[model samples]
Every structure is written in structure tokens, then in C-alpha cells.
Target: MWERNLNGKDLQFHLSGINNENFIMKDEQTGSWWQQVSGRAIQGPLKGSQLKRFSHDDLTFATWKREHPSTRILEPDPSAQEEYAPADWEAETAELPVVTPRGKSEPLEDRDLVAGVSNQDAARAYLVADLARQGPVNDRLGTTPILVLPFEDGKSVRVFERTAGGQVLEFFAGTGEELGRLVDATTGSTWDFRGTALAGPLSGSQMARMDVLLDYWFDWRTYHPDTDVYRAGL
Candidate 1:
């Protein structure tokens, strides 16, 4: 999510239109158009201005409820129930023809799902299927070391900075009772899906979370053309 307050003004936004399959938001205050993906103002008085992004996660409802039981959810407007998309919207949309240009030599298909991580001016796209098969992935984004963990539920993914206690840590998938957990090689600390150290010498330590965007390969590639694709064992 993005910060709506910019330049001392709290702006309200509405869906203005679509650009390259991404939603365009128009602010009520200045009537400026903002790109949904980049959160940058593309037109009007706020042109060239960028919105600060808030950290968010792409998690299943069950996982979220498990994490935050008392959290309040935003319910849909009862009067506008008919305006909501149906359950098969995603499946139907995926089958629709993509009008955007794509190179035939691209590493992944246009519709392939990817978890994109960006940091320190560098970006990388990790294939969701590869992550699911490989388990926890220890990798670096530019100079920042990162760890990607896929939840056992199969739909949730999280990214965290692997540096903790002045050391870079590598993590592997846990087995047996520790199933769905991450075990660090350095301290042997067992971490849950929340990136919290549950045991070992590093108990009580928390790994810094990073914002990750779960998007289609085409959408991510369209914005981050220079992004590197992560491959297993490479």
C-alpha cells in the first residue's frame, strides 16, 4: 500500500482508468494521475512526484487470521455487491489475451506468477513455482542479503533481510516437528513463518521484513525491465 498524504495534503483517490493492464488512480485534491504499480504521479501538478510505500504482505486469509486474530477486516459495501468481481475473476483474467508487447526470448511466460523483490536499486523476480519446490531461498539483492520463505499453505510468501546480530545468515527448510519453519545455519535458530526466532541462541530476535510484490512476470518485467530472474541452484 502507498501513503496517501503528500506535500502536507491528505489526498483521496479513485480508480481513474487503466494503463498497460495496471490501474491508474486519480487524486481528488490536485486531480493528478498516479500509477498503481510505481505509485508515481504521471500527470497534473504532482507530476514526477513519488509516493512512499508501506510494507505489505501477500498472504492467504487463513494465514492472516492465524497471525492477527483480532484484526478488523474491511467488508464490502452491501449496496455495491453486484459491482464486485466473481470468484473466478483471476482465472478468467489469466486466460485473456495480453495486449502488451513481450519478447519471445523472455525467461518466463507472460502469465507466470513471480514474487518480485526490490532493494538497493536492484530487483529480482523469483518464480513462485520454483520457490514452492525449493523451499526457503537464501539470496542477495544487490548488497542486501535476503531470505525468501514460502509458507506450507502454498499461497503465502515472505521476504526478509537475512542480516541479524551483525551476521549474514543462511536458512533451510525445517522438517519433522519443525515443518514449515526456517532453520538458520549460523545460530541454528528455528524461525517460524513470521521470521521470529523461536529457539536457539538467537531466540527473541526478529528478521527485518522486506516488501514483496506478488505479480505476473509480464507486469513485473514491464516495470523492472532490468530485473534478474532467480533460478534454482544458480
Candidate 2:
């Protein structure tokens, strides 16, 4: 028989899809639900590490789909994991500072939307990816991923950071001009968006979210051809 330990202080949730196994319990620090939200270890004795936190990136989404027999492997509902991700990036670079979230404006709710996971660690994945794919980059961090079109080269799409403290993701990039046009088109504002959707920041999954976000930005132009915007093109 499998031994089970349940703490009365923390509520338990039986996640059925995870390898047909069970993972549950609430966080002691916060009473938020602790569901397996990220990818597995993939190696080591602890190789199948399940992310028991709400997440949106590829790893988490993939895990969520693999275990669940029915749920489609789509991006985690952006709102569900919005806290860790920012809601705005328009002023992320100019007004924000460092690579992390600071000041009182940063809310705990968004910081640990997924509970146990570290937003700092999640943000770092984005930084590393930017470094590898592109050669040399200038960015910090703030509420969202800042897209600095520093290069005139074909390097239009890049995940720029705001500062070095390592907290926010200014927003995704496709040249600074491209961003201006988007603002002109969408009145939805960054307020309604979160994580990669609104903030342009990457969370648990970096490349996965980055690819989707860029693809989405590009696809939007298809419908607004008459806007006369995007003359520069991505």
C-alpha cells in the first residue's frame, strides 16, 4: 500500500492525470493550490519532477497535457498564471529598473501565481535564451520583457530585459517601431494581458512562449493590412 501523509492545515488535491499518479497539498507559506504545473526532471533519480504550480510555458503545459487524458496541451490560461507575468510593458524599459521586480507596486499575488515556483528563476530562462540565440544583447528587467531593437540587422525579434536586478520582463520585440504600431492597433491595453500575452515576459517556458508571442504579433498584421502601419516590417 502507498503511504499517504495529509496535513490538516493544508488542503489536499488529487491530480489524476500525472502519470496516473497523485500529487497534492497546499503550500504552508500560502494557501494557494499546489498543482503539478511545470515540466519533469527528465533525468536523475528525481527525473520525473512534476511542477505543482500554475504555469503557462511549454514544460508546464506539456506536463499538464501528458498526464491529463482529455485536456488539450494549450498555453496555460494567461490569467491563471498572470501574477508571475507582468500586465504592462509600454513603459517597462524607460520607467522600470533592474531585471527583477522591486518596489511596493510588485504584488505577491503575481509574484507567486504558481505558488512554489520562483519568478526570478523563471525570468532567468528568458535571459539565457536571448544570449544564446542572438549575439550580445542589452536589456534589464521589470514588469514585462522589454524588446530593444538595438540591432538594425535582421535580429528584429528579441526578448529584451529592462535592467539587471532581474525581476520584470519588459516585453517581446520585433523592433521598437513594431511595438508602437501594436499600441496603435490594440486598445485592449496591457492591463488585460498577463505573462507572455500582455507583459511580453516569459515564465516557466521560454522559447515556447516566445515563439508563440512573436508568431501572434506577426499574424495580427494580416487582418490590419489597411492600417498602413508595419511599413518597416518585422
Candidate 3:
């Protein structure tokens, strides 16, 4: 998710049903239009400004509650109960916009989930399935060291920088929740799926979470033609 403000003014957002398939949002303040998926202000006073993005993962509400038990959740509004009904919104299949590279082919399926990591001009994507099978994958993007970890269910993933203090740490997948989801070989700290330490010498400490975009492999490849894909099958 990104911030919704420009020039020190917070712009209220309203879902403009105009482009339901592409995910468009409008600001109540200036009637500016935005693309939610790309976090780009398409039209209006903030056209050139980009929304700041944070590291986020897509998870089921139940899983989220389990991960963050103390998390506060939004209550459904009584007045919009009908609008919020699932039956009111029917699913539609539409092709996402794609821009194929001049000579390269996409390595993964169009709809497969990919955890895309980028630093300035460098980009890399790890297939969710590969991450699940491999457990913790440590690598570098540009000069930044990173680690990719998948949840036990194999559908969710999180990324974090390997740097802590003045040294880089190596990690491996832990047996289960009792020992945490990830264990650092250097310090023996057990880190949860979200990169927070659960037990060991570094208990209660957290790793530096990195910004990652969870997108369809096709969509991510269209944007980053030079991206390297992690493929366990290969």
C-alpha cells in the first residue's frame, strides 16, 4: 500500500468503478485518478509523483489474524452490507496488459505468483512455488543482499535484507513454529515468516524487511524484462 497525499495535503480516495478490471482509484480532493496496482497518479496535480510503497504480502484474513493476533481489524459497515456482499460482484476474466521483450520470452506462466525484488535498476523474481520448495533462498540484487522465505502453507512469501550489525547472516528453514519458520546459522535466532525473531539469542529482534512486489509473473516480467527468475525445476 502507498501513501495518498501530495504537497503536504492528504487526498481522500474513492473507488471509481470506471475501471473495475484494472483497479483505479480517484481522489475526492482534486478528482485525480490513480492506478492502484502500479501506485501511479495517472491524472491531475500529482501526475508525476509516485506513491511510496512498503513491503507487503498477500495473506488470508484468518492467516493474518494468526500471525498478528493483536492486530486490529476493520468492522464491516452496516449501511454498505449489500454493497459488500460477494454476490454483488461477479468475477470476470480479463487479460492483463503485457509488453513482451524484444528477444526474450517469459519464463513462467502468466498467472503464477512471483515475489519480485528490485533495487534501482536491478530486478529479480522468485517463483512462489520455487521458494516453497527451497525454503530460504539467499541472494543479492545489485549490491543489496536479500533473503526470500515462504510460509509453511507455501502461498505467502516475505523478503528481508541479510545485513545485521556489521555482518551478513545466513539462514535456513526451521522445522516448525516451535523453532520459528527460519533460523539464522550465524546467530541461531529463529525468525518467523515476517522476519521477526521468535526465540534464541536474538529473541524479539527483527530483520530489515525489504520492499517486494507480489504480482503475477506475466505482469512482473512485462515491467522488468531483465529480471532473473528463480526456477527449482531447472
**TM-scores of all candidate predictions against the true structure:** 0.96, 0.19, 0.79
Q: Model 3 over residues 1-234: C-alpha lDDT tens digits?
A: 887666688888888844423567888988878888677788887686677775566766777998789999888898897677364231222244444333445577766778898878588988887777777888877888788877777777778888665568888877756544678898887777777877888778777887777777766766676798876643
Q: Please tell me which predicted candidate would have the highest TM-score against the true structure.
A: 1
Instruction: Give lDDT: candidate 2, residue 230.
Output: 19
Evaluated against the true structure, the overall lDDT of model 1 is 0.90
lDDT of 2 at 6: 31
Best candidate, lDDT: 1
Clash counts per candidate, in order, are 0, 33, 0
- The residue-level lDDT of candidate 2 at 4 comes to 25
How many residue-pair clashes does candidate 1 contain?
Answer: 0
Q: Would you list the C-alpha lDDT of every candidate in the order shown?
A: 0.90, 0.29, 0.74
Q: What would the per-residue lDDT of candidate 2 be over residues 1-234, giving only the tens digit for each residue?
A: 111223333333344332212233333333333323232333333344344333233223333454365975446677787654464543352243323323353222221111011123232212222322453233333344443332222222333233322333333333354442211012222311111233323222222222211212112222222211111111
> Between prediction 2 and prediction 3, which has the larger lDDT?
3
Reference-based lDDT, residue 149, model 1: 86
Q: Please identify which of the two predictions, 1 or 2, would achieve the higher TM-score against the true structure.
A: 1
Candidate 1 wrong stretches, greater than 4 Å = none
